[model samples]
Target: MKLALRKIRLLVHLLHGMWVVATRFPKATVQQRDALNRAWSLRFLQLAGMRLVVHNDAARLDEGVLVVSNHISWIDIYVINAWRPTRFVSKAEVRQWPVVGWLAEQLGTVFLQREKRSDAKRIMHELADHLVAGHAICVFPEGTTSDGRELLPFHANLFQATVSASRPVQPICLYYEDAHGNQSTAPAYIDDLSLGESLDALLRGAPLTAHVYVCDPLAPGAERRVLAAEAQAAVQQALDRLQPVTARPAREAVGVQPPEPRVDVPHASHAGDAPAANGPLTQ
Candidate 1:
C-alpha cells in the first residue's frame, strides 16, 4: 500500500512538472525555470519517501554553477535534488534507459559520449549555455559510482565546461548508511547488482539514510585542474567526516589529489571554445 501511494504521488508530480514546463516553455526566464524545477524536485523527493540533510551556503539557490560530488547509489539523484534545483551531467546511455531516461530528459540533464572527445566538447558547450542561463549542473566526476567505502579519483577533463564558462563550482559529498547503522559499500553501484536485485535489497533492508554536504563554491579564476583537485579534496573531507572509522583510511587513500594541468595545449584559448550545436531536446 505504501509503495502504491509512492508511485501515485510520483506520477502526479511528474505530470504537474510536465504541464508547467509546457506552459512556461516559450516565455520562462532562467530564474523562473529554476524556481519551477526546484519546486518539482522537492515534490519528487517528498513522493520518493527519502529524507535529506543538506548543508548549503550559497547566496542564491538558483544561481548558475557547477556541482561536483562523489557518486554512490542511483538514489544519489534523489538525495541531491532534495537539497536544491539541479540537473545532471549523465552518460549518453542513460538517455536510453526506460523510465529513468525519460525522467532525465525532463530534468534537462546534460548527456555526453565519454569515449568520443569531440562529443564531450559539444556537451560541454551545451552545459555552458545552461549555466550561463542560470541553471545549476551536478557532475559525478568519479565517472562511475563507487562503494561508500572509498572515494574515486575524479576525471579532470570533466571540469572543462565549467572552467571555460568561468562559473563557480560547488563540491558536494554523499554517504549512505544501511539499517544496522553500518555503511554498505556493496550497493553503491547499480552495475554491480541487477536492477531487480538492487530493488529487492532495498525493499527487504532497513530504511537507508543519506547524508549530503555542500561546500563553498570555487572562485571563477581558479585553474581547472586546481579547481578539480580542490573540489575532490573537499568532497573527500566531507566523506571522511561522515564515514565509519574503519572505512576512513580506504576513503582517504583514493581521495583528491592535485591534477597536473595539460601543458601541451594553450589553456586560455581552449577554455571557451564553442562547439557545433545540436537540436535542443524538449524539456
Candidate 2:
C-alpha cells in the first residue's frame, strides 16, 4: 500500500511537472530553465526513492563541454540533470514516449534518427553548433543502456562533434546501490523489461542511492576513436573504483586504482587541433 501510494504521488508530481514545462518553460530564460531542470530532477529522484551522491574530480563546466556517460535506465538522464542541467542527444523514438518524451523535447533534447544515414552528419553538426553556442551537450556514446554492471563498447561516431567544436569531453559514471550500501539492480531497465515494469520495480524497491562520478574530462583531439576509447576507460575505471572489494576481475586485471571513501559533495581534458568536419560519422 505504501509503495502504491508513493507511485501515485510520483505520477501526480510528474503530471504537474509536465504542466509547468508546457506552460512556463517556453517563456523562461536559459538560466531559469536550467534551475528548474535541476530542481525538478532532484525532486523526481527523491519521489522515485533514489538519493543522488556526486563525486566531482573536475570543475563543473558551465558550457562548451561534451558530456558522455554510460546509459543505464531512462532515469540516468534525470540523475545527471539533478547535478547539472545538460542538453542531451537521444534516439528519435524517445521523443515519442508519452509524457516523458514531450517533456524531454521541451527541455531541448536533440533526437536522432539512427536508421537514416543522412541524418548523422546533420545531427553531428547540430551538436557542434550547440557546443559552440556555449551549451553543455551530453551524449551516451555507448548508444544503449546496460545492466549497470558492465559497460558496452562506446560508439566513436558521436565524439566527432566535440572535436569539431573544440570542446572538452567529460565522462560520468552512474552506479546504483540500495540503502544498505550493496550494489542494486533495482533501477536498471534492461533486457526484456518494459519501462512500465521498470518503474514498478523501482517504486516497489527500497530507496536507492545513485553515485555520480564526474571523472576528469579529456581534451578534444583529431582522432575520434581514441577519444571514445579514453572516455570508455575513464568511465570503467570509475565504476571499478566504486566497488573495489569485489571489483569485476576483468577490469581489476587492467590495474584500476584502489577505492577511496565516498564524499557527499558534487561535482575534464585538453585538446589538440581539431580535424576538419568532413564526415563526422560513416554513413
Candidate 3:
C-alpha cells in the first residue's frame, strides 16, 4: 500500500474513534466501557500504524487485581486495553490532552499529581478501594517512561495500597519490535518527543509491534519495597530474554543495578509492606 493512502485511511479510523468516544463511550455501562476500550484501543493502534503482539500468561482474575508494568509510551495504555479493560493511575497532566484526555477519563483512569506526596495517599486509597470493589487497576511504577531500551528503578510506594487491601500484584512486560522482529525504535515515545512526533515516526516507518508478557502475580508481602524489587526483577528478566540486546545502545544488563532505596510514600497500609518477596517466572 502506498504510504499516503495508508495514512489517509489511518486518519479516517482515528476520526471515527474520536466520534465514538465523544458520543457513546462516556455514557456506556461497565461492560459497554470494556468493549469500547478494547475496540477503541485496537482502532487507535491501527490508526497509529502499529500492530500488537501479546502473549498473556496472566492467571485469570475472578476479582479485582492490581496491574503493574514499566512505562514506555502513551501507546502502552492502548496496547494493554486492547487486551482487557483496566483503569490506570496516570499523572494529572493527561486530563488536559484535548480529545485523548476525554477518552482516557471515560475509560476510568485515576489521576495523581506526582509532585504532591499527599496525592499519593488519596490515589492509593482510591486504588485500594477499586481493588476491593473488584475493579482492576494498572500502575506504572517506574514513575515515568524509559527509552524502551533501559529500565528504570521502580517506585515501591505504589504497591502499598494493593498490599494493604490484600490484593495481588500482576506484572506485565512490554517490548516494541520492528516488522523484522528485531527490537525497534519505531514506536519509542521516549526522550523529548511530542505525541505528534511519535505518531509521525510510527506512521512513516515500518510496522511496529507492541509485545506484552504477563509475569506471575506477586502475592502481597510484608513490605511494599520488597514487592517492588521482586516485581522489577521479574520485568527485567523477561526483557533480558525477550528484548534483543542489539536493540539497545547500552550494555546487556540493563536496569540490573540495585536502585538506591527511594521510598517516598507515607506508611499507612499493608502487612504486605516489602522488607521483598520472590516469585519464580522467567522469559
| Best model per TM-score | 2
How do the residues 1-283 of candidate 3 rate in per-residue lDDT, one tens digit apiece?
A: 6767767765565556666666775567778657665665666565555666655443535357888887777678777776665788877877776655665665677888888999999988898899899898888898777766768898888799878789988888888777787876676677778776766776776677677777778898889999999989888876776666565456566554332222121111321111000000100
Ranking by TM-score: 2, 3, 1
Question: Model 1, 1-283: lDDT tens per residue?
Answer: 3655555655565555555655664477755655555455544433444434554434324567988888876667756664565788777877887555765775677888877878977887888887888778888888877776677788777687777787888888877666676775533545548655554454444355556666667776546688788888888776766666665663443543322221111111221111111111211
Candidate 2 C-alpha lDDT tens digits along 1-283:
5877877877776776777776777788888777776777777777787878887645457789999988888788778787788888878877677776777777778889999988989999999999999999888887777778889999999899999999999998888888777778887787888777888887776588888888888999998999999999999888887764574645544566754445553210111111100001111
TM-score of each: 0.74, 0.89, 0.81
Candidate 1 C-alpha error for residue 87, in Å: 1.5
Backbone N/Cα/C clashes per model: 0, 5, 9
What does each candidate score in C-alpha RMSD?
A: 10.8, 7.8, 11.2
- The segments of candidate 3 whose C-alpha lies over 4 angstroms from its true place after superposition are 1-12, 58-62, 245-283
The number of clashing residue pairs in model 2 is 5
Using lDDT as the measure, which candidate wins? 2
TM match of model 3 to true structure: 0.81
**Candidate 3 backbone collisions, by pair:** 221-272, 222-272, 222-273, 223-272, 223-273, 223-274, 224-273, 224-274, 226-276
